[model samples]
Target: MTPEPQAASTRADPAILSIADAIAHPVKAANFPQTILRFRNDRHAATIGLDALDDKRWCHHFGRFNPMPGNLPQPLALAYHGHQFRNYNPQIGDGRGFLFAQFRDDKGRLLDLGTKGSGQTPFSRDGDGRLTLKGAVREILATEMLETLGVHTSKTFSVIETGESLWRGDEPSPTRSAVLVRLSHSHIRFGTFQRIAFEDDAAKMHRVVRYALETLYDQQNGENDAAALLNLAVERMADLAASYMVAGFVHGVLNTDNMNITGESFDYGPWRFAPTWDPGFTAAYFDHGGLYAFARQPEAIHWNLGQLAVALRLISDAPPLIAALERFGPLYQQALVRRFCWRLGVVPQGMETDRALVGAAEALMMQGGLGIDAFFFAWMGDATPECPADQQGTEGEALWSAFGAVKAGYAPARVRTHAYWQGDAPQSMLIGEVEDIWAAIAERDDWGPLSAKVDAVRTMGEALRG
Candidate 1:
């Protein structure tokens, strides 16, 4: 389980999964990232795409490839296992999935180019290998939207419709099947460790963890003992949860296996943007108890991190890992406040003001039953805010009140109509257009326009400080 560089028989490295041999098969690298369409309504998790549980992947050059290319990910793919739901499902590993290969994009970012709706493997359990079209469609929309929102997400590389009918609840029965391609840093999961550890491969487990840290985390020299590696892993997950909170993003299904040790948002199952300000909002339909609720996500993430610590503890002592775990709450708080402060056009110095402003924003959003996205959208244009400013406070109330009054005084009625939510106050005309532009950004991945908007938003925010 050691992460020795290019070990004779270690787990799969992203480089091993590279797309060097995949330029010839039935492949399409789209201008925009895509969704798998066929697995949309599988009810397993958010960002559900077509499950490649059964189809065999081939080289990009193959005319009618059945399994995998000789150089493709075969042996390294054997390193994964996970617990699905709350049950200890040690039988999970790429059941409906497999990495086609990993590659460096034109800009030098590493990406895993793989297929969903590909056929079954040893971990197939009992399900079919095919994925439905609607699953593909939903995933396409989810990926595009999330990335546009500036999220660290798995980008959809392409989508392939096999022109075959499959059945599912989210759409008409006898629907078509498809394969989805995703470009990500890594597909390795937390369960990848748990599964091997549970199997009594302490050496293999240690090997894999060491490999992951070197490959993904720092790619630096020297080895990370189990203790150092575990601390690194905890800090990453903590930072990730912190970032997710700031982005108003919620990962609906956060099983131990779903959490990626690489610090990227791994699985998109049952995921959703906060619809309203309710932290209790769950992205998955099956999460009736809100186990993976938007409000609960950070906590859920910490819980998953705890599980990771235990698994890592099998090789080392728990003291350092426990200390790393203790930092999550404060780390989360700082990240949350820092991010919220930036969004509000304020610095982090205003504690009471920042707290009140965020509290007020959430409270007003609750009263309006506005989704997080909706509230932020409305806040961009709100002139006569239903959200009140505390007359007595120096920072919180004054900042909001002053900004609201100045904004309403400057915006045009037509712009207000276009940008403001119903019954909300007018916002600064300069930024009103910004919201409209970001909507376009969120809906489309054609970076031609996205590039301009990204620059424009940052410029506007910077101008506010000056």
Candidate 2:
């Protein structure tokens, strides 16, 4: 069952406490040298009734880690094990962050306030618990862009610049430091189950499964078994993979720890949007094998789900888990067609025609080297299709035919009425633009470009939403 509607004044529910304490360790937040507020997502805050907080109180709650009313008395550094790049690691958990609080949105959906770069915990091993200010900014941009593109992503609720200088090999030494708070559906990860399974605790695993089904997921048919939970997870992740593909996003690292049970995309690390439809496009520089590249995301997610299934075998039989895992392929294909049609601003035909349309779009992008943004911007809402003159042959012909078939089935669903649509190009958050935004802040302490970019991105989202 879903959590009861939280009282207006008692919003911080802390549902995770119902689980075993062994899964989470009580921890204190780091005392930062400074607490300068960088960003607060008022729009998302309003959903959970945090929009009314003044900057001072907001900083106290987020930056200083003060407990909210009726919330957890102390923060919890959640414990779990994960497979990093397919190498199983038993010694990993929340090293720098913790679950701050839990609450229900205005719509009664349970949500969590999880932190990043907040402090060190028992899990911190040979590393200082800190986050680069540049890293927080990138997460802000990534979540904003992904949410606008119709991906189910976590909202970057707060970013506070903590007065500290952090060293990292990937970035310039002694870069600025900060903390990030993410608003997400749940922080429970696939690795959470792996941790329990590692210890062979079947009863505790069952308790976690029940907590997930009752609190996190909605059941239409009243199923409440481990297999049912696995099925729902599989379906949600399949849709997520499809959304990432349609949005041209590369999550960079699709580790089992990063794959949350709720299927919402969070934990932005070296994320990037592909400039084009290159299957081999990789976001993280460390991804030499391109394991989580643009084209391999679906397979990676499927593999992670297999790990989840393996863990679920502690409480479920192999046959049911296998059946659940098999659903990912068809579900992903369906989601791809649905999201692709939605992004194109067109009414979709039946599955066969929709798949043909998607196939043609992929072929066109690969053959012509067209950027994803340019292709989507040119084709929104039944606008005139632009085909390059050089390759008006087979690929172009297939694309135009697909467009006609789709348009003939039903009229375009989106209109260019919003002022954002009046712009010549779509808003894109490519790596070059991200670096430029960071340079403004790093060099001159200028936040004008970042603010302007966020506003433009939001406006573009509004235009797309309409």
TM-score of each: 0.68, 0.95
lDDT of 1 by residue, 197-256 (tens): 787767776667666766566555444366676666666676677666655666778888
lDDT of 2 at 266: 96
The root-mean-square deviation over C-alpha atoms between each candidate and the true structure, in angstroms, is 10.8, 3.6
TM-score of structure candidate 2? 0.95
Which numbered prediction scores highest in TM-score against the true structure?
2
- Give each model's clash number: 59, 0
Each prediction's Cα lDDT score? 0.54, 0.90
Candidate 1 segments exceeding 4 Å error? 1-14, 17-79, 105-109, 169-171, 219-224, 342-347, 350-353, 380-466
After TM-score superposition, the amount by which residue 409's alpha carbon in candidate 2 deviates from its true location, in angstroms, is: 5.2
Q: Per-residue lDDT of 1-466 in model 2, one digit per residue for the tens? A: 2233333633667889999486899999999999999999999988888887889888988999988878899999999999999999999999999999999888778999999999899999987989999999999999999999999999999999999999999999789999999999999999999999999999999888888988898553344388998999999999999999999999999999999999999999999999999999999999999999999999999999999999999988899899999999999999999999899888888789889788777866776657898888877885766556754775666666565555556568898788877778889989999999999999999999999998988888888889
